[model samples]
Target: MDEALWAFGRASGVVALVLFTASIVLGIITRSGRLLPGLPRFSVTLVHRNVSLVGSVFILLHVGSLLLDSYAKLNVTDIVVPFIGSYKPFWQGLGTVAVDLLIAIIVTSLLRQRLGVKVFRAVHWFSYAMWPIAMVHAIGNGTDGTSSWFLLLAAVCTLAVGTALIWRLSSRFVESARLRQESV
Candidate 1:
């Protein structure tokens, strides 16, 4: 039973990482108004939202399974509060912090209309922090973190998100430059 729980925890954690990477990349692409052939902007936006929801579900499963696993010995407090766990406290705490940030982002998005766009946008920016924290936690705390497969997966995810971010930033820079040229 303990082994099963451990395996489930590891699998769920990996799945959550993959899904989160996809969500981040999709979000950047959506912001840039980039779409695959035959897909509209709204479709990209919908996919980004849905991917985030699914990634959150996987993250919950990852936390739950690890908490239940006797080998991990994670208490509920460890899952919520940062830096107090018996196990690899620093890395685990980073994961906890990322989870907290995700919760804030999700709640703010849900209340976006009431809170207004500026508030939601400000909260959403935390995702940039959350993703790298989560990645570091995974690489630092994961048992298979040094394995070839996990390294490849991490590399691919990093490359995809990095490319999207570069594209998004460069496009924005070009737009600002164009505006400045016209103004001048």
Candidate 2:
């Protein structure tokens, strides 16, 4: 039973990380106002939203399995509050922080109509912070952290996100410069 729980936790965590990576990339694309080759603009937004929701579910499974596994030593408090877990406190705390930020993002999204776009976007920006925190937590605290495969996975995820972020920023800068030149 313990082994099963441990396996479940690890697998779920990996899946969650992959899903979140997809969400981040898709979100950057959506924000850039460029339609994917076969996907409409709205389709890209929908895909991003669905990927994020699925990633949250995987995150819940990962945490729940860890809580059940004696090896993880996680309690309810450890999930909600940061830096107080008996096992890998700092790394676990980073995961906790990521979860907290995720909660805020989810809540704001659900209430977007009532809360207003500004509030939703402000909270959504937490994704930038949340993704890296979660990645560090996975690599630092995971049992297979030092394994070659895991490291490769982490590197791939990093490269994908880094590329997307660079594209987003550079495009935005170019657009700004173009607007300034036109105005001049």
* Best-performing candidate as measured by lDDT: 2
How many collisions between residues are there in candidate 2?
A: 0
| 66-142 per-residue lDDT for model 2 (tens digits) | 99999888999999999999988999999999999999999999999898777877888999999999999999899
lDDT of 1 by residue, 14-41 (tens): 9999999999888877665666668875
Clashes of 1: 0
TM-score of each: 0.91, 0.92
CA-lDDT, candidates in order: 0.87, 0.90
Error of 2 at 118 (Å): 0.9
For candidate 1, list the clashing residue pairs, or say none.
Answer: none
